[model samples]
Target: MSQPHLSSEATDPASAALPLRRVLPAFAVDVALAATLSFSTLMLGLFGWAVWRGIQLAQQHGGAPDAHALQAQIGTPPVLFLIVTTLVSTGGTALLLYVWRRRATAAERRESTRRLGKPSTWGWALAAGGVTFLFSSLMSAGGRALGLDLQPSNLDLIREGFARFPVFLTLFAVVLAPLYEELLFRRVLFGRLWRAGWPVLGLVLSSVVFALVHELPGLNGKPADSTLFLILVYAGMGAIFAWVYRRTGTLWAPIAAHILNNAIALAVLQIYGDAPA
Candidate 1:
């Protein structure tokens, strides 16, 4: 449920390993748990907003001079509330992952014993970061060759908000996000796919899914031709992450690389541009 299909003592020896069969259902369970926790976090945020603005909303509805004006006065959710909700969601996820991993069956616990070399190294992390940048740039250039008018990522907008509240964004972008993502994408998805006898195919499938999740939402008003380009870039990045995970035999490698990538993206937005700044 947590990671690589590590065998128990007297090891399954890889030949008789049924890791794919065992890990699939475990992954489904983890996804359901994460989703439920995330959903609950969202609901709590909404509830908090309602509590904070309820009286004002009630006053507005009680025949204010202008309903629109009254609602506008409420503005958006407070940045503090945003900070709180993020903490809740991420904290909840981490706590849940820990709980399930501990309570899991002996087979699941065996994931710890599957270690290859060192779980992670600073060297691998930095190389992965470099790979991310190079591959993404290559894909972007290829996209341009095809007459696509690609735009900067929507990350600028998110980064602007983060700049104002550096603490929460630091935690979110640099720590929580990478950990959760690696757990879901590399540990769960990629591990199973690889164990299922998909080497090249596993890498491609996992990377494509990872990239789509990031790219699709950002494509709303973007030019059509740029779609494939973004997917390629993101997928390439995901592939790098998967490779790093497999290379290190731990999630730390990808998480470190991810944090570096996100940190760079935020710094660029802070230094060069970003309308909100």
Candidate 2:
């Protein structure tokens, strides 16, 4: 009896319709959590820098320095900032996802577990990664053909930051990032809406949001046409990840694919970038 109702709830036409009220809370929570994590990581970086600067100023000036003086001494400790934020965001998000999974319904848990246990999931991820890389390259070429500059600002940042701290940045960009991002964007943001019968909405909304989050920092002073093209490139990548997640029924699928994609990008950056010749 219970199994039948469960099956029907998953398959029923009525359930296929939007369940906004039921899903909205979860969706809101997901967004809130991701935002909070980002904000907290940023604040932590600022706080660390402030504390370090304050102590330095006190030692040199023989007293607690004023805000004006501290402001004058302000300099970004990029390596420290990156390391701290990476740990906070990645660890915090992993814990959050764990708790969310634990609270999920039995059917959902079973479905996830089953998907995770499948060997074919890795194969799907590898193929998805290859296809996504090809798709992104074509998109970039298309944008260039239209005379739009489509360079990814985030990749530039990663390349610069990686030069400062090669090993940790490599680990973060190659491993931790894929795990953290796919879980946040695909599993939380996209999955909640998808399970609530808004699959298309899930894909578009999550992809756009993901792209904006990544690209907004670099968009200032850019031409509108180029900005739109850049956003579309990233949004397309996010859509691929979401699609793979939906098809493979496992976050690991997208996570693995994301890892592969990032690895390839990092490899390209190293090969063609300004390495000491």
Candidate 3:
């Protein structure tokens, strides 16, 4: 039978090593998609401000805006920017997913099916989330030990944005974001690299890229040192998610952990943030 040849091909070390050019999105599409999402986010920020300003103008009968409205709108920019980007990125992520699914190799499909059938695959996601949470906490502590203060950049801005628009921002963070991010970082990019015979390399690369994209810049809570440590913290979480994805061979594991992590963060922020006197 032909089974022997198939077994040898699977076992042969040389067969696992493919040409570097084979990893298209792994080397190219991932970066392109990231850049596209960033550009769209920036453009949406400007567009949202323009649209809001027009609405304010109409409400104010062409006079100067009320002080309260102006104050509230202070946080509108970032919130609107993310909300719009969520919508735009959702479509982009979906398209990428479709393309990858259609083009996936038979081996990859079989592996995915096998992983999906395992009961323990998804159960590991909860443990992964807990581990990542500990990792994030450790990174934060380490940053503090190094005298860096190390709060997220624009932490207050994000909080205020949530205060101004809680529902949409919450949905974006806890739901839309995890889905979109998992699709790009774990599903399309990691899966592509996995199928391309660079699973370990893919794990590290996707995690680093994920962290880089989310490292909020330009406004730290304290200014003791650079953002290198913060990047490590974010990267740690990304690595955990990537590990979950790898173990399960399905996007659901990492996606669930991501949502849990974000949901916990959002809840903590809402619950423990500054209280009124």
User: Residue 40 error for model 1, in Å?
Assistant: 5.5
At residue 209, what lDDT does model 1 achieve? 67
TM-score, every prediction: 0.69, 0.81, 0.73
> Model 1 Cα displacement at 94 (Å)?
6.4
All models: lDDT?
A: 0.62, 0.71, 0.64
How far off is model 3, as Cα RMSD?
Answer: 7.5
lDDT order of candidates, best first? 2, 3, 1
Candidate 2 wrongly placed segments (more than 4 Å): 1-14, 64-69, 90-94, 97-106, 116-119, 145-147, 217-221, 274-277
> Which candidate tops TM-score?
2
> Candidate 3 — what's its lDDT?
0.64
Candidate 3's residue-wise lDDT over 248-270, tens digit each?
A: 66677787788877777777778
**Model 1, span 160-202: residue lDDT tens:** 5586878777777667767766666665556655554454555
Model 2 lDDT per residue over 1-277, tens place: 1211001112222346566887777777777777777778778767877788779878898987788867778666666475657668655664575455423456655676677777887788899887777777787778788987666655556777788888888888889777777767776678767767897888998898888876674444567787887788788889988888877776778888988888877887799762110
Query: Of models 1 and 2, which has the larger lDDT?
Result: 2
Clashing pairs in 2: none
Where in model 3 is the C-alpha error above 4 Å? Answer: 1-14, 21-26, 51-81, 90-114, 165-167, 216-225, 274-277
